[model samples]
Target: MQITPDTLATLNNGFNAAFLQGFNAIGSQGNQYQQVCMEVSSSHRLENYGWMKDLPGVREWIGPRLINNLEATGYQIVNKDWEHTLGIKRPDIEDDILGVFTLAVQQQGDIVGRHPNELVFAQTLLKGFTTTGFDGQYFFDTDHIGYDVNGAETSWSNAGGGSGSPWFLLDLSRTFMRPLVFQMRRAPEFTPLVSPSDPNVFHMNEFLYGVYARYAAGFGFHQLAYGSKQTLDAAAYAAARTALGTQYRPDGSALAVRGTHLVVGPGNEAAARRILLAERDAAGATNIWQGTAEPLIVPQLG
Candidate 1:
């Protein structure tokens, strides 16, 4: 089958449903948790369980499978060496060795060629802000002593002012493996218009407000725009502290907030880094500003 934008969309929808089912199943089973610390490398000649071979059982499999599904829809994967393990220390080890993997997917141009419908959806979502105005009557000053002014002056403002439209930029270089990187312009348009309490807007809020979250969930990768490790680490620490609170206790504890963790599975190292970094920042770690990691691509698949 020739993978095109329409096909990719269909594939993505199916993939998401399937992926969620798999994740929920794994979560309920409790068997996946034990696999986290399993050794990827050989322990010794005598201790040869070959845990690496059981990749399907680990959480990492989620990412790879998603990527494969995207590929099946015609997206090419970009190949890059992303640092999987960092600051990791084994009891007697000195220097930390990193593990790497090559991702698979098609490029954006290729996606456009094959899946133009998908590209259209992406572009439409990527376009500039939608306009809305506040009524002058709503802004009238009650204390004003006007001759016979019925209401206050109304004005139209760019809802998504200062911040541009929310867009998902693709990393052109990592076309095959990591094809999509979303750029959410922090604009009014991006903000949820409906009040959380309003029943009429509840569903709207749930759908529109979820663009970023859905994007993050859909794409199994993140990007750290701020280049330096220290900046990233600092941001991570601060977020963790804020979420957990200064005083740690067994009870009344908040959710743990930390920097991004690798999407344990396979494919496209650079894209993985982007995904992790994005997740870390999205979780409220803003000290490390997203910088020149421009057009970061996120693979549509796992």
Candidate 2:
């Protein structure tokens, strides 16, 4: 059934109700966290077991070494220590969905039927939030590899997700991550808006949120940019290209890192596109930067 006004109200009202008070503690007093969009290499992924897989340090098996073991002789891994083999523990971001409702209400003459604006407004909220991961606070987190009881690693690369999931690539090796992976684990169960304080009243469902990236110190400082200028230019594009070229992988080999996507806020989309999609070089005589990357308009970045 379609989401109705009452349903939207249910979700909205619940959101207005009890928020995760404790979760609010994040990014409130401590040092502010910044989400830097960098390139990440899919070649660096290793399906090692445990929380170690999510840890930045464990990603050292990049390049051709990752799957080369299977191609070689007698390649059978044997690790049967299940007594203390902990399950893949994802960061505690909660994904609480409001209860489903019926759109089955037929419009009786002149009653105006379901509120026409309700679904639209609801859609607005969702669309507004779709690219909001660029902002701070408990938002969508990247998924980690799950493991079996025998401590064997499970593939996250299913038709359902895994490799099909969105990610970036760093020209660098596996030891270093170019694009910071937003590790997350959505809550397995959901609670409909129900009142525990008082059974008669509907309570907002709990939407828990928590996300963590690696140490900010890991970020390559020189790679950051903010010229003493106002608008995008070929010089700026050239600098970005040069910086992206420095991304390295775990094998200590240089990766083919290219910006490929110049994501910008709605306000900056035009300017960013002008630099990236220009038919002629914004700086040099050639159209070098043109088509090197597309301008991704993410209004939320604003």
Candidate 3:
């Protein structure tokens, strides 16, 4: 499939995050350096394009790109220069560097999906090898099943799945265990604080305090686009409440929580706060804690 500029940018961003995380994780293991490099180099050669096959230098181009991206993202380089980073002396024998690269690419795929822009670029590099019938699938000897009904390897046929489908097939060897579900009771006195006259306040209050509310409901919180603060606050509050497991009855149907507060006009923080304070006092929520105005707290999963 053809890649668009936006898709490419998303791929790059995702790859950068994945690569940094992988590099940090593996590079911390001191003794497995050479093995790491070999795995990376082999994987890259298998997956990457032909121009990279036998470049005179020990360092691969993608290696530097991955490293640079990681470093830019505030990750510290655990190993020194690649030539001596893994305690290896021989140029041909060093595999730790390659190992790092391989881990980075795999992690990137997991986070951003397989067809990331970086993967696309790497595949494009493979065009030179493809001219010589060098398809990447055989670079690693995965397995060899016999021909299918069409006398072609079953592997060559369409798998009847699209992007995001699992490539391998295997059944779990044991029974899967299920987790316990906890049912929470609705608060008796809880009432929505938003009013129609100052809808911006509702959206803003939600944007500000809905973070904790969303977490209570079991979904993650994110920032709302800037607009009418009062309306946004009202909506945000309702959204956050719903996220926190509060059921809202509308036409006798319970709506699944979708956590985003829509605003009607330009958002004003000052006006939003004024409306929120008046509503909070009216609702008799004496324990309300006020903090410096900020859009959504930084999510800490832990």
On residues 196-243, what C-alpha lDDT tens digit does candidate 1 reach at each position? 354533443221111111111012111110011112233433332232
lDDT, each prediction: 0.24, 0.30, 0.23
TM-score (all chains, Cα) for each model: 0.15, 0.34, 0.16
User: In model 2, which runs have C-alpha deviations exceeding 4 angstroms?
Assistant: 1-178, 188-190, 193-230, 247-252, 281-286
lDDT of 3 by residue, 37-155 (tens): 11111211113222211111123566344322111212111111111011111221122233454354545333322222122112221121121212232221222122332334333
lDDT of 2: 0.30
**Model 3: lDDT to the true structure:** 0.23
Q: Which lDDT value does model 2 have at 224? A: 20
Q: How many residue pairs clash in all the candidates, one count each?
A: 32, 22, 34
TM-score for candidate 2, please give it: 0.34
What digit string (tens of lDDT, one per residue) describes model 2 on residues 1-302?
23445654565344323222212323321111123322222222221112111211134656754342222212111211111111111111112222221110111101111111121122221232122212211122122232333334442211111221121212223333333331112211122322224332323333222122111111121122111122455665565566456444334344344555554445666767777676765455667666776665443334
Model 1 weakest lDDT span, ten residues long: 217-226
